[model samples]
Each structure stands twice: as C-alpha cells, then as structure tokens.
Target chain A: MKYAYYPGCSLESSAKEYDLSIRACCQYAGVDLIEVPDWICCGASSAHATSHLLSIALPAKTLVQTEKMGLHQIIAPCIACLTRLKVADMEMEEHGDLKKDVETVLESTYKGSVRVRNILDVFLNDVGLEKIEKTVTTPLTGLKVACYYGCLLTRPPHIAQFDDVENPHSMDDLMRAIGAETVDWSFKTDCCGVSMSLAETDVALELTNKVLEGARDAGADCVAVACPLCQSNLDLRQKAIGNKFGVFYDMPILYFSQLMGLAFGATTTDVGLEKVIVNPFPVLGAI
Target chain B: MRNKLEEAKNIMKVAVKEDTTAFAKEIQRKCGQDVLTCYQCRKCTMGCPMAFRMETKVNELMRAIQLGLRDEVLSADTMWWCVSCETCATRCPQGIEIVEVMDVLRETAIKEDYYIPVESIEAFHKVFLRSVEAYGRLYEMGFAMDLNLMLKDPLKDADLGPVMMAKGKLKLRPHKVKDLKSVKKLFENVRKLEESRV
Candidate 1:
C-alpha cells in the first residue's frame, strides 16, 4: 500500500524517534510512504489560538498540496497534526464559504479529497492486524504496556471520528497483535498538557505526573503513546515530575510505532530507541 | 426582624443592564459556535483537565459569553490555561464545542489588545508562529532560543539542551521549504483577511 506521509514539525525535531520508528514499522509492514513535497507546518495550537482563519488556512495549504501530488490518503504521525488537518478538511467540506475563504488564502481549491489518518489508524485499520501479526519476528510477551491515547487522537468525537473517544482500543489491539500485554487504564484519553509544557511547566508537569502515575498504578512496564506531544511531555519531563513530586518514576515512554518496530525485528538504533529520556533497554531485554 | 430584612434587601440590590449579545455574536461570526446552546450544564467544567488552574471554569466562560461579559472573559486566565484537550467539547451535552469557543475568545482578546493574564502563553504563541512563519516548520532550537529571549531567561531550559543534543533530537539548522514564498504569501493573505474582518 502506498500513501503520502506528512511528518509534521515535531517528527523532525523533538520526536525524531517517532518519525524513525513509524517509517521503519510502515516499511516492515510493506507500506510505502511518499513524503509530501515541501510540506509546511500544520499551524498547531498557536495558530488556532491566535486566528481562526489562519488555523484552517494553514492545514488547507498542505491538504491542497497533497491533492496536487495526486495522493488520496496521507498519514500524519503526530496526533496534533492529524487533528488540525482533519478539522480543516471537515470544516471546508461542511462550509462552502469557509472553503472559499481558505481557497482564497491558499490560492488553490481544496477538494477536501485527501483522507488524513493517524499512524495508529494506518497500522490497525489500513494494515490488517493479522498481516501485522505475521510480520512480528519477536513477540513482546510478558511486557505490559499502557496504551495512552491522550487527547486529539480520538477526541471531540465529531471531528476526529476515529475510535471510541472515551475508551479507545485501537492502540491496545495493535499492541496485542504484536504480542504485548495491554493494560487497562483510566487516563487513556487524558490531556498531556502539550503546549502548556512550554508555557506553564508546573501545570504540564502535574498533568504528565497523573498519566505516569496512572500507568504505574496499573502495573505497566512502560507507556506506549501515538502523539509527539504526549511522548515529549511524558518522556522529557519525567525528571522534573520526579523532582517536583518527590516520587521516583523511571517508566519509559515510547511511541507505539517503536514497539511495533521492535517486534518487526528492527534494531534499537533503527527505530531511534536510544533517543528516549528514560532507558527502555531493561524492559525490552526482559521480554 | 427589621434589621435582618434591611440587610437582606441591601445584599439583594439589582442593577439595570445593557444589551450584551455583541460578544456572543462576535464569537458566532468568528467560529460559528453558539454559546446560547449551553444550558448552564457543568459537564464541560467537570471534564476539563485545566479547570482547577483556570480563574473561570469552562461553564463559567460559557456563561460569560452568553451574558456578553467581554471584559470579564477576555481578562480571565482561563482561556490561556486551556490546552485544547477537547474533553469539554466531547462531554458537552449541548454540543457547543467549548474548545472552539475558547479559541474564539483568545483570538478576540488578542485582537482587542487586552492585557493577557498569562504572558508566558502569549509569548510562546508569538515565538511559535514566528518560527513557522520564517521556516516552513518549527526549528526546535530556534524556537527555544527565541522563547527564552522573549521571556528574558536565556538559561531557563538550558540544562535539557545537552541531553537533547546527545540524543540527536535537536536540529542545529532548520529545513526551509522550497516554496517558502507561497507560505509567506499565505500568511499575508490571512493577515489581510483578519484585518478586513476587524
């Protein structure tokens, strides 16, 4: 299967491992990812918070470019990017006036033809679970994983319209297909305090602490995530969370794709496993 | 009994109000979210993760919008604290999409040049957009540098720099898209449209 890949900003920077692992996993699953040429940022939280028009227009520009490339489906690994792109597409399809405004800003008509899918969706739905199971060279047996959906992935149900917003099970199913134990946790769709991590570190730390503590309480060996922001906050800020809360949590936060890559026999370096803040080698070695 | 009645009368004094539908109308015009649909249900507030940190809760903000309390809503730190988790929007029985409402309020606050209670969030937004405007994508190092400079704390997150570098996560240079001029033009067109709306 072939699809266009829009590896938003975080993939190339803070969440490079996500990009690496996602590509590796897709390749192993026999999926071809053609990167969108000269794709711009999706104008994430800042654009939406600042200007309503710009937020829609920003993603519209990229979607229009994808149409120009003649790709009908695109996989945006970052949950936030998928959310922004999907929302823009939905708005333009639903409102002709907004579509005209966006077309005017982008100087191109958005056909609303491109289907935006997150990586989790690409794996679970696009590539059948049975097919993925057949490709697993190393079954992650006995390794308990807390599958964190965070927000934006399946939220505001009308816009995302993916898995069950409250209790998403796609990631869990994907993990199970790879032979990993998926733990049932309450904070599956909780907020990770994303941009707040940069603005208000304290609040973001508190939210991240809750997610990490929840995973730990449920006896998860490590946390598996699908969003760049979730991985960044949960992985990078664990130290600060520990120092602030006077609790030691050495839990490793990993992208779901990385775990799949591991099961597909990809090396740690191949998937950028060493890039994580907390070392995951111990847990990976155990299984 | 007379004294208690007088005290109660003083506490219950009411004032005449002016028409305040303009705030709600403005929100509707901007994002098409109708705050009138909200029936004082606290579901949004209950589901909001940042409600505890907000000066005004999600339901309170909806009430402020309905009442056209422009000054009260604009000056409050609630909108800035919202992470746009969409939990409120997901749980809202009215289907008001409180997240979009918050976005509209934030845009209005910025347009009116209200005193932003959370300067850090405003600063972060500015730096983030500036980075994307210059380069097609966000330059992590440049963004951090610019944010630190704007916040006047160059060494704020300095400790994480080396660690990130070691992991090969920090990019020393930004990748500018080939058709950057088009991106610039898009920004200009949007800016012009925003100005025209105002």
Candidate 2:
C-alpha cells in the first residue's frame, strides 16, 4: 500500500501535529507514504480564489510529479489540498485549452490519470473497517467525538467523489472502528470561515462560534477533524472566539488521525497532542 | 471580467456595453458555469453557510449576473466572504457551479482592481502566491509577516508567531523546493497568459 503524499503548506507548518499524527497512523496501518519529491504548493484556497490559470497550473505540476513518482494515487490529508488537486484533475480532463495551457505553463503534460484520495477514504474503503477494528489495541469506548467534516471534504459532487457530502459517515465509521462513539451533529459539512479567519477576524470568529456552539450543544466530549483548517479554526481560535462571543466552550478539536493513534496505544506526545490549543488530554483522561 | 468587476470599483471606469449578456457570456467563456440558466430557485443561497455575513446572497448574485448588473455583482463582498463550502454548488438544482462563479468573481475582481473593500484577502493571496513562486511551498512565518505588512496591520496575529514556534510548527527558515527556478517559471507563465487573455 504505497502512495505519494502531498502535505501541502498547512500540514508542513501550523498543522504540524496533523502531519505527525497522520504519518504515525499510516506507519501502523502498513501504508508507505512516499513524499512526492519536491512537491509544490497546490495553491489551495488562495490560487483558486485568485487565478484560474495559476490554480490549474499549480496542481498540474504536483500531479505530473506524482505520475513521475510512479504512483497511480496520492494522499492529500488536507481538505483544501484534496479539493484543489481533485478540481485540477477534473479540469485537466474536462477542459482542453486549460489542460494544454497548464502543460505549456509547466512545460510538461498532465496525464490526469492520477487519483487523489484523502487518508480517511483510504482507511475506510481501502483498509476496511474490520482491519481497523482489530488494530485498536486501546479501545476508546467511552470517549464521544463530534466528527467535523468541513466543506469541500466531499462535495461539488463531481470533484471530491469521496463520502456522502451532506451527512458524511466515513469519519464516523472510522471513529466507530476505534471504539469511539460518534455523535450526530448538524455542522458536519458546515463552513468554518477558514479563509476569512485571517482576513476578517470577527466574521470568521462569529461563524466558527456557531460550529463550536453546535458541538457543545451536541453533548460531545470533543471534536474529531480530518482537516487542519477546521482543527485550527475550531481549536486554535477557540480562545478568541470565546473572548469575542462572551461564551467559552473548551471543546478539544482533535485530528481524526491523532485519535486513531490513541486507539492504537500511542501516547499523548506520540501524536503531538500537546500542540493543539484546546487540550484533548483532559477529555481523553476523563475516559 | 471588466464589466462585472469594474462597475463596482468605479462607475466612471465601467462602461456598460450594448449587450447586457456580455458579462454573462464572458463568464461562460472564461469558466464553464452558466449563470443565465438560473431561475431564482434560491437553493444555492438557502444552503450557503456564509449568507449571514454576505451582503448579496448566492441566488441574488446569480440573478445579478443574469441581468448583467456587472458593477453590482463585481463589487459584492459576497464572493470574498464565500468559504467555497460546496454546499451551494452541491445543492444547486440548476447544476450551476455556484462556487466556481464566486471564484470567477474574485479573479475578475483582481483583474479589475483589488478595491472591493476586501483587499486584505487579496493581499494574502498575492503574497501567498509570491511565496509559492519563490519556494514552491508556503513560507508560513515569512508570508504571514509579509501579509501583515501588506495589509498595513503589522501587529496582526503577532502573538501567534512565538506560540507556533514554541510548538515547533513555525520554521525560522523556508523549505525551498529543490527546483525553485522551474517553480517560478510556472507563475511567470501563468501571469503572462492571464494578462494576454484580454
């Protein structure tokens, strides 16, 4: 089970713990993650938001490199990265001039043959639930988690083509495999205003406040997320979000990969759990 | 791009040509999404999570495009506030790629000018792409600092620097891609292509 890995920018910095935990899970899952040699930034939320030419051309370079690496599929753990790469792949196949222009920009042809998959999709579909169930050495039986699937995880249907876009159960199913109770929540595919979090602080904070309030109302002990942006927005900004709203809900925004590591008998430090703003150790400790 | 984006920037600069559908036609030509086909179902606006913060809702903006309200549609803060949550796109009954339309609006805004009262995000993207062009990957600390300076709010997110560095997430130096020169050429080529299109 070897695959190319494009960590993207966030995973490399700010979301370092997410990168660590994901690599740790893949190691135990017996999956080999070959870092695509000199992978370029996929020009995520920025490129697509700014320039169509750059958006397609940027990810085209990454896809070309993945093919050169001889991997038919690549794993991009970040939801934004997954969307950008997948969208670029779709554009490469559907648009003739765009593809040609992209190739001309890079001085390379984009075959558009490479498939982009998120780690969760690989674990649930490729690795199967039974294997995951048996791999859980320390079952998190009592810990309740609200699985946060930010927008674009599986949507604009033709592109992501991953789990059910509206009520994504893929993360819940994975959480169940690790013996954790997945809480049903409304903000499953809600927008956390990730891009706005930096630009318009109040707008982003107020929007994130809704998700935080939703989870807090759902009676979950903590939140489990697949995307780094959600984790940081919900966790990293929890303090400011609370300060602005005059209500503080200390729900830990954990990486689904980190929770998987804990289920596999990994310690807090092993998955870099100490790095998150809202600590999950106390919540996990309660169990 | 000019009609929709430029109208909002400055009425004097935007010339509403004879064809009202010219803006719609330009959008379709640039990107495949069709705004003229929308019949005001409002499904896109209904599912939009950011509607609370948007001045013009998705459906309203779609109608604005259809009516050739170039300046009104282009100057809308709605596109900038969009998180690209795909909910609107996924739920649109007309099969209109609403998110793509927002992306198109943003790019058009850039082409016209970054004077849509959301220059901060524009600054971020510009600096972000510059970082990628320089190193093939985001130079987080450097980019954030540069973005702050560009936005003229240098003290913004100042506390996050040391906190991130403490967690070993913020790197003092950038992880430059091995083939940095080739990566830069891609950006240059794209810019040349963009400027030459019109």
* Structure candidate 2, residue pairs in collision: B4-B70
lDDT of 1: 0.90
Candidate 1 error regions (>4 Å): B1-17
Query: TM-scores of the first chain across all predictions?
Result: 0.98, 0.98
Tens digits of per-residue lDDT, candidate 2, B1-198, equal 878876676764454435678889889987888889999988888888788877888888888898788988889888987888888889888888888888899999878874686677777788888888888898988988898899889999887777777778788899998999898899889888877877
lDDT of 1 by residue, B1-198 (tens): 999999878776632245677889878877788898889879988888998898888888888888888898999889999899998888888788788888988888898899999999999999999999999788889998889889888888788899999998999999898999998999999999878876
Cα lDDT tens digits, model 1, A173-255, are 99999999999999999998977887678989889999999999999999999999899889988889889998879999999
**Residue B32 displacement (Å), model 2:** 1.1
Candidate 2: residue A130 lDDT (0-100) = 92
TM-score for each of the candidates = 0.95, 0.94
List pairs with backbone clashes in candidate 1.
Answer: none
Best by TM-score: 1
Query: What is the Å distance of residue B88 in model 1 from its true position?
Result: 0.6
Recovered fraction of real interface contacts per model? 0.81, 0.75
